[model samples]
Target: MKKCRSLCMLFFVSFSLWNCEPDHKKYNLETSALLALTSTTSVPPGSSFKLPDANQTICYDTSGVTRACIGTGEDGEFTNTPAPFLLQIQDSGETILEESSELTWQRCPFGMVWTGSTCIGSSLNVYWQVANAYCNSLTTAGRNWRLPTAREASLLADHSQNTFLPNTYFPNGQGAGGWTSTPAVGFFGRYLVSSGGNVTPIDETTNFPFRCVSGPKAPNASFTDIGDGTIEEANTGLLIKKCAYGQADDSSCTGSASPLNWQQALDYCNNLNFASRTDWRLPSIRESYFISEPSIGNSNLPISIFPNSSQAAISWTGTTYNSTLSTAHAQMVYQMYVYSKTDSANVRARCVAGP
Candidate 1:
């Protein structure tokens, strides 16, 4: 009996020393299991978690005898404290991302021209029917269409930089009202005029200016080469065609193209399906000319189609003036004017795509 007691006492002392060792990495986990369970685990402050959650946030000191963090709604319940409290080291090493908001947007690459610090572009002013039809025609690069957001429209200001002007000069005092995706404050997302400078709420029937946007104009994309290629994945149903017949000039054919008429043109490009595409339509004047080459007289079309195309004769565009040419009164209608092969000639129609 005395020998057994001495052996038992010796075993206890040896076991205690083994567990008290500082270097735990060298210790076998199976053998260390015999040690205190609480000693190996850490708890942090400002960390919250549930049992199913394995992401342990070390935001607290998980040392010594701490409160028992267990049970459903007891002290162990995951609260506002971080488990294993410690300052979180950033893994991505980034705290901010490039903002997509209009305020942060400095330039527009697709159809917009720089005015001051803001980007400005032309838009069609028409009733709801014409407005929707017009928006359906805009195509940037290969993208068929996109209406500007309220914020995007409001971002355009006379004091801002990068805006479109009537003249080639960017800073020229030329601006147009644009389309807005934002609904009025008191109304739905409708009846508003966006000028990239101000958002004026109006009735849907009121004629207003509008602008077009390229599909998420990426950094790698070029403004001058807005429509230069085709898409590999055509989920939008319309393919991006870099043709010149629909553009103002050879220099401006970098946008999408759809062979269509004014009425069917919108449907053809925006809705697609020249044969089967669901998104197809005609491009707006600005969008159609994002890649427009300047011409003098009615000279947008190919010389073969309109033989009169010359330096003096500018080409005709699909977009028409709202008011008819008359010395007596003004009329409201979408009309296009440009050089024609004949004095009073109507040419074969073309189309473009939009988002």
Candidate 2:
């Protein structure tokens, strides 16, 4: 028994996921341990999940046409497939345990009931302000629920399909949209999961359906400027080059970046010897999230941290795009998308090192 507890502790610490006095139910120890072993990275299992998934199996070129993802150094070439998540459906399917994130979600939106097979009844579309109050009022499964943060809300998206939620995990669960707790930078209002799977700020008075989630706080990426041209993300031990490739780095990156094809981008990082370190490589799709605190808007990147990055920072990722539940995270407007590895139109490269 002691050995089992020790292993579980290691799993939680390795993934930085264990929460004290969790507001929801505890995870099944045996299952979590096995899941932790599924990771291919240095970190344990929970970190390998391909959150906010993408689905661009067919690569596109600068002219916006479909092609294959072979020699193009595109996302489809490098993205590692994530293993399946073990969903622990509980409370007679009213509650769902997303074991990978350790977040329990209400299967149906507000005003709907899980009728064993699917959610029945029309969902309530509430304003941004009411989202929190409504979620807080819930006593579902004896856990304190709240509106999910932007990051948490992103995790719910399955970009592999056009639908918001796959019917398998969430049957007939589609609503107009859902509200996130992230306040927009300006007065646009709160963020919402649009029908297209992107999170954009909408007017405060706008109504959108919402679901409740109960979990420990979501993991965030915090960075420290390394005096050199790189910043270290405290959470993932990833050191990121401040500027995208082709941009000169000094007191904030400047100069128009020279766009590289996907393959050349990969070569540039592998050959990079910047900051007296030669270990740099392109960031995987999941690793890209830990690079910098994402900007919900294009210009939100602080000049000190990511100067001159205000434009739609369409950058290349090491992860290849696949039309499965397991791939893609190219960032645009702080939202996730896929770029054809061969598309030289606008996508640039940002190199990273250390996990």
Candidate 3:
């Protein structure tokens, strides 16, 4: 009977210990899982769980690998974190974005009138005020503006089109004969007005008109005469004057005039006695008229040639008055009436030749 009682007690103790072992192991496993779950981004399989502690973020995923770290809520809860995002930028390389919106005012060359991108008008006319006002009222790109500098003004005159105005704008138009930005000093033999930075008398207030232009700054030089290795100014261009002998006006005589009778003057010319060149000739009545000097009443010389050694004086032509005495001469002088009477002996003579 004693042996049986001892065996029963030992069996009871072994059964109790075996049952407690499983509970202890499960508790340890649960603790380990909770520690990992504190990250707020992982989950354990087949387990009902909460945040490790009130401050724990409780990152949880379906498989515990796909992570989403987020801040913990007041009750240790978490909101869904937004997905990742990206940004993009645009690029603009080396090109100017032109504003081709509408018509506006623009300045043309000094002597030109603006008609869109083209400039037109006589090279002799178009003074400053007219030009400025016209430019101010001229419309391009939706604005009115004054003409550009000599350089900027020339862009409108396209020699390739042979047009002062583009053919597209003026189909029946002649060669492009508009204002330019080039100054007269460079190739036009520098004018008096140009020296003072003023417009020519031909472009007087009552004579010339204005054109408008506006756009990019006018360049330094406008039209280039590739043919003659020259550049035409925006205002004057190559139209101002034509080249002749070294002489300008009628007074351009290479040799001193000798007081002579009609026969003597003729003989002198035939001899090529003047300027070493043999092609000397007695000018026609019309040609001689340009050399005639107006009577300034002997007051100081006119400002035209004052201070300059080149004094202008009237000269006689070789033209004959009639079949009268073989030596009768018809002298051509400036500012004289064609029907007026005049003495022949008092007339002065200047000789001219061509190169």
Candidate 4:
């Protein structure tokens, strides 16, 4: 009877222990299965899931890992965190994703090797002519490629990166200099670079390297005669003085504007009231380029609208030329090129109003 009682007690203890085991393990298994099903059913491949906020911008890391709310804190404040799923990065063709601009760029810059997502090769340090030729010859992604404009080349400047460029996308690119399609003063070409952390231009020659970009060109500029000794470029929305400063004539500038130093020219435009408007200032290199009609010989400007435009005249731009605070950039409208001139050097000024 005692032996039977002991056996029964042992069985009872074993049964109690078995029943006492925690139920959490089974619950966890069930929860995991439900999550898997929900994920599969809710999110489709190549589809995006919204972040916590609708305004939050999505960003990606160098390894193609995606994250959310990685903006520069310009549009309000927010916290950044890694996204749940990796983005599908495609590197199969002549184009790859340019994360910064979110545009697809060519896998290589003309003569470089496309290594998966990035281009890897030394850039050819060629002249403006050669650079343009190389870019024109390129046939990538079934499209013709051409050299980037100054504005387009400026987009590649990434101050956050060590080389001031997105090296991951433009590997082996020269950070100091790259040629732009925009012409500088004289026979030079405009090149974009961050010299001393400032976007500045240098004379384009056979010494500089260039990168090609593929995009729609800016639309042709249209002119409207304001009839108040000024004309408005319809495309750029800039009000240009009909005649150069100091050569003010309703019909045409009989003489060239008196060449003043950079500072003098700036002050002249700022103080002088024109066209019943007080806000007159120097045009930027870009702004000056906008008015330039390279097809027109001699004056390189629309002669009928802007009469007496001189090819020999070099106009001072508001932009500084280099790291030197004392120098400024000037544009030669006739040749469509840029060159650096001292602040004290005598240069012409054509005032512009509005952007």
Winner by TM-score: 2
lDDT of 4: 0.49
Q: What TM-score goes with each of the models?
A: 0.25, 0.66, 0.23, 0.55
Instruction: Please write out the lDDT profile of model 4 over residues 1-355, one tens digit for every residue.
Output: 4234423543554355346434312323443344223111112344332211111133222222333422211111121211111111334644544332233345444345665555655544654545655566655566656766544443344323336444554556546346656544333334443322233345433446555655444333457779998888764567888788678566877776777766567667767688898767776544565565543444646788887756237777654432233355566642223333433445787887764
For model 1, the stretches where C-alpha displacement exceeds 4 angstroms are 1-124, 158-173, 188-196, 217-355
lDDT scores in order: 0.29, 0.60, 0.28, 0.49
Instruction: Write down the TM-score for model 2.
Output: 0.66
Using TM-score, rank the candidates from best to worst.
2, 4, 1, 3
Quote model 1's TM-score: 0.25
Candidate 2 lDDT score at position 116: 75
Which ten residues in a row are the worst by lDDT in model 1? 325-334
Off by over 4 Å in 2: 1-86, 160-164, 173-177, 259-298, 309-312, 316-330, 333-347
Q: Which stretches of model 3 miss by more than 4 angstroms?
A: 1-127, 171-203, 219-355
Candidate 3 at 298: error in angstroms? 30
